[model samples]
Target: MYDYAVIGGGIVGLAAAIAVGKRYPTARIVVLEKEQTWASHQTGNNSGVIHSGIYYKPGSYKAQFCREGNRSMVEFCQQHNIAHEVCGKVIVATEQHELPILENLYQRGLANGLKVNQLSAQQVKEIEPHVQCLAGLRVPSTGIVDYKQVCQKYVEIFQAQAGELRLNTQVQKITSRSDYTVLETNNGTFETRFVINCAGLHSDRIARLTKANPEAKIVPFRGEYYELKPEKRYLVNSLIYPVPNPAFPFLGVHFTRMIDGTVHAGPNAVLSFKREGYHKTDFNLRDLTEVMTYSGFWKLAAKHASEGLQEMVRSYSKTAFVRSLQRLIPEVTEADVIPTHAGVRAQALRPDGQLVDDFLLVSSQNALHVCNAPSPAATSSLEIGKAIASKIPEQSLLASSDCCLVTTNS
Candidate 1:
């Protein structure tokens, strides 16, 4: 039996595996992925922003992990010679009404110990020539890098330590005994002393397989994006963000100049019929049925009906999307952008219609589950890995914690 078996091959899974391998050098560990390649889903499909800790609640996992991760991720990139840029980003407020929200965000950044500066309209123009905003916050610590490459490095590190990785191995069932856990898969069956479930989109299902009742269900919300055509790339010199609505988890449409100098726009959040639905037409009957029947989803839908309708409108109409973009940079037009890609976020929803705001971890005596990790997760991967490694029980020393984060000092 392997000492540890980590499910899912996303960036977080790979990072967690590497940390575990390092912590117990002699332990036999296996990283399993249903897909043939690593980071094929969320990690590869992101905009590559190295998020600052500014957006998260103070003392929460997202804040601490992101702040620490920003440093460690940059160090890793430098040491590994990964292509990256520490280009700063500006969170802009276009209308007078958003000024108060911007101030609150600035204060939140200060509370998180971030080096963020409030900027006047003219000062914002000095940084982003084409942008127009009533006020702005310049976050010099935010950066960008290709996370897929970082996942590659994690795979290498873990494998170098004699860790085994099995591709195309889909876990079909889990039988957790008092002594050990058995992961039955399409390829074969494997027994391990412990399991780490980092299966992003399917995490809830995976938890259920292990007979753990996760309070929240995973619901997929597709983030649709577009890239500015080559000639129009000048509109964005760095990252530009709109002040996010506090009631919602999604940051509004904004511009980001990637490390390679391509500018990506938008990512309006819309509900997807399928868990892995990257296109408008992609659908799965079961995925659709589960979400439609979920009381939490319907509650959330009813609460955000108006904003939800707008997101759906923007998802379909290029004109609606361009209007949102034009709010930040008035020069943007329908001709400037071309549809690029879409990523589905596996958000966890409570029956009360509240989204899990922080990193939610649930554990049994022999297994740990990372149920709801999205957005800044890529940025927080390394620190999160470190924390999980330090916590993975030696011979089930860990106890049962249900539907709550297994807190560790990061």
Candidate 2:
């Protein structure tokens, strides 16, 4: 018997378990990971950019968590001796027609309380010499860090508080009793008073298992990237993003300088057939069938058919991907880049063709489910965990009472 059982060993799940353990020191806690290692999904495969809350809407969860997360992440790294860099990023507009949109982005960044400055073409050149832009927004707070390392650190800290980790445990069913819940897993069954469903890819499915009606459905979008050759790494100083297409769910292809001192280019978003699929042909028929059958999926596809088609074209044609990148830096060529790793984003879409923008949480009598956690989630994991820990019913008890008084099987 455990006080809490956390499903999924992604950064968010691990962070949640860590937060819970701190608040409830004597409470038994366990984390279930379907994979052999943690951060094997979104957290491990992301672009590794510590977002500065520039692109998110002001007063929204994304904006709040990102800004707060940026500060906290820097502090956490310093305290734990983690390797990270506060390399700033630039969002540029190459064509004159994009100037107004660029200005709007700058204003939005200002509203979001980010350290943003509008840059002239010459100023942009001063920062990123090889880049071309009509105008741009410089976000100085953006940075990079290996999220996999961050996840590892959390695992260490969580274990210090006596938290247990069970890997390669695939959950099959969940049943809630009057007091506790029973989790049937591939490894063995576990009983716990409370559960946190931080299962990244299969979050919605987990919620349905607990009889909760999650309004949004998970739609996987694969982001394919290319790394710049060693000689051309200077093309980007830090990060170079395009003026996002507001109509689409993804931030358009961008260049990022990773913490490992390598610059990567072009993460073109396309519909992924497999949830964990990194390759172009890594498809799961069941996943594809579920997405194809969802009315919301078709609605979203029809709404952004042009952007969707362009993404597919870029995925198949390297020249097209380079063309998109050339919009920011005219010097980039197909020969200057090579295929890098890819990541699949789990975006939640509604039947009305709306993309769920914020960090969405849905809960039931015995379980709390994180339905949508996208970019900046890795950066915001610690703070997000603290927030989620506060919401659980056991939180108040843990903060004030002794675990010896609460009977697990009562």
Candidate 3:
């Protein structure tokens, strides 16, 4: 029997396992991943930007974790000889009405203790020659890296510390007993003294399997993207973002230069029919029924019906998507970009229709559930893992009487 069993082999789960192994060197730990490979979901399909904690509310968990995670992530990458860039990004205001919102963002960045400065239109042009903005906030700490590579390094170090990993092991049920928690999976049954649920897309489902009500439902929203043609990549310098609408959770369409020197733009958000749907044609009946019937989903839809319709339009029409991108860089045309892979965000929505804006963790006697983690999660994986590990009771690791049955694979 293992001392700790972490569900999900994504970056967060791997980081948590590493933290637990460090804290309790002698404890037996195992990471369970349903997929055949690690980080095949959200962790692998992100924009790969190392967030600078400029957008999160001050003194919030996201702000604190992201700020620290940025430093630690860079350190970890350097220590492991990983390829990463500490390039900065700009949040621009092209329209007159967006100027105030840009100033508000600058103030928020200052309150969060970020190294941010407001730039004039000429200064913005100096940084990004092809970009046009009335005003901009330059965040010097924002960077980019390949998170999948980082997750791989986390797994390497975790296994080197004697932690176990079981891929393609889908947990069918979770039963909490007096002394241990038993997990029935497709591969076999396993028992552990403690369980940490870091399942990203199906986090709510996993929580329910453990007999806990997370009080929020996972609503999958797909973000579609387009890559600039090789010759047109020069239009974007590093990263250029719009003044995000405070009322919305998404950071509208933005341009980002990847580590591989490719420029990606236009990720318009739309309601995804499948939890892991990467294409517009992909659909899951069960996933569709769950969201369509949920009262919270309807409430959220009614509130942002206009914005949602616009996102849908951008999703189907390349011309509309290009028009949205033209707000920051007026030179981008529909033919200059090509459709790329899309990513589905597992957003947690409350019964009252409020999105869980901060990191949400729910705990019981012997288990911890990561209910909502998205966006900067890839950037804040290590800090988030440390936070989750700190919450696990110390007594659970050293208790001898808690030993339970272990099922060996045949």
Q: Please tell me which model should have the higher TM-score, number 2 or number 3.
A: 3
lDDT for model 3 comes to: 0.89
Candidate 3 lDDT by residue in tens digits, 130-171: 888898989999999999999999999998999999999999
C-alpha lDDT (0 to 100) for residue 38 of candidate 1 = 97
For model 2, state the Cα shift of residue 32 in Å. 0.3
Model 3 regions more than 4 Å off: 397-410
Q: In what order do the candidates fall by lDDT, top score first?
A: 1, 3, 2
Model-by-model lDDT, in order?
0.91, 0.87, 0.89
lDDT of 1 at 189: 98
- Per-residue lDDT of candidate 1, residues 234-285 (tens digit): 8899999999988777999989888888999989999999999999999999
TM-score of each: 0.97, 0.95, 0.96
lDDT of 2 by residue, 1-410 (tens): 88899999999999999998888888999999999999999999999988898888887777888899999998998899999999898888887778888888888988988889999989988999988888888899998999999999999999899899999999899998878889999999999998888999899888888777677889899999999999888778898898888778788999999999999887998999988889999999988998999999999889999999999999999999999998888878899999989999988888888888888877676777888998979878888898778877663122212211111211
Clash pairs for candidate 3? none
The candidate with the higher lDDT, 2 or 3, is 3
Maximum-TM-score candidate: 1
